[model samples]
Target chain A: MDKKIAMVDDDTDLLNIYKPVLEKAGYIIKTAFDSSEGLKLYKEFKPDVIFVDLSMEHFDSGFVLCHRIKSLPEAKKSKVIIMTSAGHETGIRFSTDTEEEKNWIKADDYLEKPISPRDLVQYLNEKIFKEK
Target chain B: MKIENGKILVVDDEKGMREGIRRILEIQGHKVDTTDSGALGIQKGIATEYDIYFIDLKMPDIEGTQVLREIKLMYPEAICVIVTAYASIDTAVETTRMGAYQYIPKPFEPDELQILVHRALERRWYILEARRLREEQAKHLLEVAHEQSRMRTIINALDDGILIINQEGQAVLFNPGFLKLLDINQEISIGEPVLEILPTALRDQIKEIFSGKGSVNAIKQEITIHPPAKLVVMANTTPVMGKKGELLGVVSVLRDISELKKIDIIRSQFVDMAAHELKSPLTAVQGYLELVVDKTLGDEPDLYDSYLKRSLDRTKSLVNLINDLLNITRLEAGKVRRELNRQNIKELIIDRLNFFKNDISERALKVNVDIDSNLCVDADRDDLLRLFTQIIANAVRYNKPNGQVNITGRQNTHYVKIDFQDTGLGIKKEEQDRLFEDFFRAKNEFTRNITGTGLGLTIAKKIVDAYAGKIKVESEYQKGSTFSVYLPFAKQNNFTIKNSP
Candidate 1:
């Protein structure tokens, strides 16, 4: 069976562009246009890997949705990746030391947008699809 | 009482006695007045401020003892002497009890009389000088107290928070500004330890300062107190050295710079957002062009054409974004020279309506114009034309099919107002506040398909503001939105034209 992945973002154009790029790399894809639908789909599909935009539906809603998934026992092994165009300026380093960094962005990995197709597939193979 | 010469009053039934007393006092450089009768003596005593009085017991109108008693009761400082011929031990004791200075026999000694007058004048001088010294001391004390109070008022009125600590690291003085800045409400007094009086973070700094480990100059920091509210402060701490070079205490002056820090953060965020915004379209253009050139569309004419079109569109949007950025920077930097002219607002609206005729007709938007032909606004012609073009274009672009756009103009004292009302995608109440902010656009289903650089309203607002005017919006989500601009009226015959440099 093909591994399942879900993407949540408010930007439809970017989502459309990303959908084929990820699916061409041989993975089943599901998408939600907003945070509410994203949460609904996350519970129903329970995808192995989730791609969430940082400010989807509302500011920092991606962090909120990721926290919900990570707190669930069933979703513990799922790879949650946070993507942002704003992170280009913020320089967000994923470290678990500080409480602020942990609470707001506790994800398995992070990606900055305008991500090349080649880099996206390689990052996915290494971070999510490696052990499986 | 006179210090150089004393004034004296003499009362006696014998004319010789009165003359003799007056001569003795006058020769001693004293001003002496005489009244033989006790009645006249009482009147003279009430009228004059005599320093000394000589009274006789044989007076017809009043006895010497009675006269002495009355004079003493009136002016307690008056020195009175009893010079009576009937003087005896009993008489002397009685007169002394009635407030007489001393007794003189019938054959009075000149030296004795002279000595008695001198003694009376000396006592008056001492009493007057003592009173003057006492008053001078009180005035000096009052002046010192007033000066200290004024100093205390000035210290408390300062805007910067000030904290003074003793050599033992105890808080000796804290101003109201200090308490307000720290948000501390408890009473702080002298000898309170720094840790007890200040926040823990500040206490650590103070401890470092006293121990000679902190910065010798001012230390600046941005701190968030109470979990959410952030404050930036510049604190200058210096040791107060005594005259003998002993360390007295530390003085800390705290100035709030949170507003300045906030502006810096906003400016940086604006720069980042602008860069990202510019990169987004460029990335899409690059990707599409690369796809077309690399023949990734599989040599299908339609696919190639579509990709090429998308690339061109993105390229166009990129150009528009750069233009908007340049416009905003030029506007903010005040580098754009304005050509002031008297512009007919009604004609301007008609011209814009004709300019956006295709978009308006495509959207089936009805145009309604209600304005006076002579309504004029003071503005830069090109800028005003651009301003109206943006507004009417937005009206046509954001309108629903078969929508109506009403352009109304009216003039009031000192100003002309032009309103653009569109039955289109209105903004949310919360989002409308930041609609004119740089790079802000309403993110919703309605605006998803609407093509905009999000800088139209920002530029429009900038233009209106440059004219020393105001722009405001009223909106109801999904119903309609109205954007109104108010501009100053130009005076007749004061028009001038120039190109933007």
Candidate 2:
């Protein structure tokens, strides 16, 4: 099952690393370096999942980019993902996935940076494939 | 001043008996008077109010008992002893009821009469002195009592708890604060040992240590008590001293430093977040850049060379920024481990000088190093290195190209001093006071295009404080600045400097 994925990061190198990996796994990848460009690209591509880096050129850019994409009528149900570094994701608070709030820009996945290619494929399979 | 014994009066038909009694009493320092006849004795008694009446028992004119009854009626306290014979001695029992010293029968021994007279005089003197002293002592006691009550009033009014203990460590006097702070209530009493007033550990610590050589030395310790384990507190203890330099007891103020602990938690969080923010990106940049230059550039030479050069340049910039951020965060966290080893004064300056070689050569700058090589100081190596980085980097950053930065070190047995003098744009005197504060940039930020985030001296000061050393800056607006650091010398072999690359 091929899926379309859009990723946004202010760090060009991190975007370059994940874009190639996602593309080879049969997921169509779209990239943006900052918030305004990422939102425009998100509406046009309307990808199955969105991965936003927490810090862009400005801090908290990922939250801004994710919120803008989810507010749109066409992308409300899209599975939004937050990509982070290992130091970023160890222990953060989250609600259970079954809640109705999951419909809008659901950050159902987290991928730690220097992320291995195998773990990423399995994660995408579990969130996008297993849901079916 | 003289009150006669008031018991002896001489009255005799025979003048010689009268003279003998008068001569003995007068010799014994008594005031005496005599008469020749009972009529004359009665006349003297009536005229001058004599204390005793002595007449012949068988008087030719009048009976002695009759005269005695008249004398008793006239002055009841007066003693009237009738000088009589042995045959008439049975009647002397009546004289006892009549208040006589005793009957002196005719032909009495002169010694017996003299002893009687002496006993009577001393009794009068003793009674008078006893009565006088009692009144005097009562007045003195009242005055002393008033002063003690005033003293207790003053001690009670003091906010600091006051306690006076005897050599036995028994709390002889403790103010209201002691009992109130300890929650002992009004049930506390005098003579209770201090241990009974406080928690068990505090009592033992104070009693054991405070009584020894530590009496003058400060007893600063933190104690924790748990009541079923829900709360925690930090207590700071300071010793209280008396005017004579005596150790009264310890005054411990237990404030709950829980908020300070929470701030520590928040600080560690900031360090973690900031470190993660800086390091994760740098790691990716380093790792991936190494991968690209290794794998992607396989002898195509020209194309690979272009990519390698660009990546290394950016990687180095990221590394420097990471280093700067690391230095700031670590110093702020107080994580730099410091040792108090004797550091070679010249080697420290030389090593520090060598580190700036690449940086200084790029700008063609010069630094004068004037410290002797033999001088060494006790200091922390890594901490001193970070200090050097901040000071030297600041010295270069704030200076013009080819500016002279002088680094000097001098050492005595007790202390070692180092100075980094730079001929650069000096700080304004107005900003000199706040030069060591964090995140404060000079007002002339625009005039001097020194690229700094302003955490250099702030971190440097903290490091110096860790060693109990001092750093001071002397600067005038246009006259360039000199920053001096003084570090106390610790014993040799205190610091073991490892192999340096």
Candidate 3:
């Protein structure tokens, strides 16, 4: 069975670019332009994996959505990934050493953007879907 | 003889001696008083400040030496002369030792008597004049000391730092204010070379002023103090010229302007960040389009479609950002029209809410409205509508799912207030003061994903200010936020809005 993945971002064009790239990697993908739409799609699709931009519809809205997904009993086994452009999106640096950082973002891994399609697929296969 | 010139007293047991002495002194231009007994002479001397006294050694009651002692003790400046008919060596030595000026025999010549009287009075005049001159000099010195103290007080009381340098670049005068402005210790004594005390940046300008170089007549410059304490100051240096218009030294005044410099730096930083923010989107758009042109995903419609959609969205966001910037510029420049009409407050808010119905339902957020429908205000309809839309839309967009948005409106005697309160990501206390400033968006983990141009609040504030209204925010980080707006009455009561701009 193909892995079910959902990606949420306000940049619809970026989503369009990411959607086919992820789809061609033998994963079924769903896309949303905002946090509200993303949450609705999450409930309907019950995706096995989630990819969200740190800034979408609102600053850190993706983090809030990720937290909500982790709190759900039905989605307990799902893998969540957070994306950002690092220096491009924000001026602050993040450290994963602190438990507070991991719990708040509720993501299993981070993907810095401007990434090629091949790198995105490889990162998912090795870090997320391989465990399943 | 005038008594004011010199008063003389003569005392002797023999009447001939007394009368002869008195006549000689009187003829020599002195007011002479004769006494037949030494006791009488002492009594007269006690009554006045006599300039000269002549006493006889062989007196019946008091001795001449005794009379001389009484007169000299009372008035030490009086010149005493002894006249004794005995003329013995013992009497002469005894009288001279007892404060007498000289000893003259009773059978003395007229010329000798006259010369003794003349010399005694002259010596008395010299002593009085010397005492008078000494007192005058003491008073003059006191007055000069008082004036110098007053001048020092005036210079030290000044707020601006002042320093007067000598021709050799030595600190001739360093006011207390100058030392404090530079944070230099008081132990740094005056007369030290200015190079040893002042920072190089300020010392250079002062040297330029003294050297009569570019704009040296009066030099004005901004300088930053060297580390350990970084301070900005506006230094004004002017040449202190002498009577011949020669450069004596330089007088420098320093005014602290670090606060203003800090504000200027912040404004410039925002401008740079704004430019970079605009360029970043362009760079991303260009990169994606180049990939499409390069055929990285050859013969694959799905792959190219995604890139093209992303490019289109980037263009759209870029347009939105430009529009936001234009609105702020126009509003700040006061180009927006303020055509006011009587507006039903609740109805306008409802109209704005209708535009956000989709967002509210999609988020499943509850909205509570407690507003008086009859409340009306004199305001421009479009401006009021936009104000409501932006504030309420922010409330919905930043709220958590299942959270609540509460709106309330009330009218008082002078103003009408509307509050949009939300259970959303709140602002930090430190960041709240700068929330309305242009390009100032909260940067944190929770605020990083927010989609905004950071110009919304700035424009909102400008619009509210045009109507002389006020907007304030209160929030607790991660708890919630409440934005309150107060719009004053357009005019007096019992009148409707009817102004056009």
Candidate 4:
């Protein structure tokens, strides 16, 4: 069965980029620019995979949204991933700055920026198919 | 055998008796000087610094009492024994009151004289010791006064407000800054309970800290007071520890972080302005691309096709950039609005995951979901779902070839948790710290070659905060990473899907 994935990010262009690549690879993609729209689709579509962005509206916007979904009773069975461009060196979750800005993580999983098409699908196959 | 180095002072208006006493003492290794008048006797006593003095009870010019007073004033420890003949015992006893060391009645033996001199010397030694102790006490009092002032001055000059409390939680020392911070004054004292001095809200925080449940910095709270007027202060309470690491008390510094606060507002404004400016053109470009891609003109569309495609790519990039910028700005601002509601956890994950199925298929990455589907959380649903979308996007965007990503969720009493596991190229342990920073990419140039605005995850974290949720990640380089999100649970025993605007 083709793996269906949902991509929730405020950036439409980034979401669309995956569309062409994943569609060519034989998978379906549903995209939303904000968590509100994403949640609606999350309930209705129940896609097999999801991609979340952290800096949606702020440093940890993705974290806030992912947390909401994770807390829901019915959504407990869903998987969410975090996306951030800054590498580990920029002190992603462990910045020495004030506690408020130091950490910005809260999702099912996270990845560095600039994801390649081959790498993206390979990872999904490993986590979803291999684990199951 | 006259007394060596002795010039005896014999003062008596009765000249014959003075001579008799002087002669008697001179015969026993002594040199004697006799004065008939009381005034001259005192003058002699003063001029000669004698070891011993013999004064008659009755003296005319300078009464015996007057002579004794002058002599005692000159030499406080001088030995002056009053000598009285028969029937003048009362006068001799009275003379002892006038600074005489002792009284000697007439018809006394030489042994009596010897004993009296020995007692007088012993008394003088006692006087010296007493004087020494008094001097020492004076110095100690002065030193204590000096030390007390120094301590008070330093306490006043310190940057933070300092209130010294005893074991009873009573304020022993409260500086001006401390008083001003707590809005207390003259009424506070050593035995007064700290609660009485501090505002009600602050007192509650102090109680929490004392119980060791919360940290001072972690609970840094802002309090606004309108007593003297309106003022905003961020109060941080730190427990002061003694040399033995005992909890001495607490010291709180209310530093004004207002400057940074204002700067954050300005930065957020910049982000909004930038998003608006970029989105306006991006929307136009997107519309134009849609129209052209639909072959609206029905002519040779090769040029239009490529132009539209390129425009679409550019617009997508612009959109990512704007979103990233906005995310960074919001998280830095520190305050996230909360619109609470219950959300379906499973639905949110699957929905977010669906966005990238095509990409996952093309890249051949596996996906897994292992979660107890009966979980729900109370939070802003919009922010929650977006949080999942961003993280999942990150996993796909940065996976190694032939890797897998697992998405799992579990429900507990108060929270719902989501876990995104990836078998892709995991983040390096050293580089994990900055993973959430805006626009920070990996050091590898090849990784940088991928198309990303480098703002995805940063925005995701901010969105999580808006929902009052927590996010965490675990990754091992070349192994994979797991990102987890936790949100408040639903109380109505059901999941409702909602989102923030």
Top model number, TM-score: 1
Q: Per-residue lDDT for B333-448 in model 3, tens only?
A: 67677888988888888888889999899889998888887677788898888678768877987788888999999877678888999999988999899989875667555554
Error of 3 at B489 (Å): 4.8
lDDT for model 3, please: 0.76
Error of 1 at B175 (Å): 3.3
- What candidate 3 gets wrong by more than 4 Å, as runs, is A1-132, B1-160, B170-177, B184-195, B208-222, B226-228, B236-246, B300-309, B326-344, B350-374, B377-386, B395-408, B412-415, B421-450, B458-484, B488-501
Q: Model 1: per-residue lDDT, tens digit, A1-132?
A: 888889887666555555665786787889987777888898999898888877543345777888888877887767788876663333323223467876656688777777755567788888667877
Best by DockQ: 1
Candidate order by decreasing DockQ = 1, 2, 3, 4
Give all candidates' CA lDDT scores. 0.77, 0.64, 0.76, 0.67
Among residues 3 or more apart in sequence or in different chains, the pairs in candidate 3 whose N, CA or C atoms overlap within 3 Å are: A13-B309, A13-B310, A16-B306, A17-B306, A55-B449, A58-B449, A58-B450, A59-B449, A59-B450, A60-B449
- DockQ-best of 3 and 4: 3
lDDT, candidate 1, residue B84?
76
The most accurate candidate by lDDT is 1
Q: Give the TM-score of candidate 3.
A: 0.47
Error of 2 at B214 (Å): 28
Model 2, span B193-274: residue lDDT tens: 6656566655655566466633545444444444423223443444566688776666544434446766765665545455
Per-residue alpha-carbon lDDT of candidate 4 for residues B1-501, written as tens digits (9 for 90 to 100): 222445568888887777777766667666778888888888889986776788776666766777888888898767687776644656656666666877777767777776665565456556656777999999999999999999889988865576655446777677777777656656676677876657766676667667773244335787765575545567776676678766667666664445666665555555544544354335436544643555433464774666477566667778677776666666666676757776778777788778888878878888888876767777777777667778888788788767788888887655677889888778888778787765555544225335566567777777776557778889888788899887766766532333323
Residue B105 accuracy (lDDT) in model 4:
75
Compute the DockQ of candidate 1: 0.20
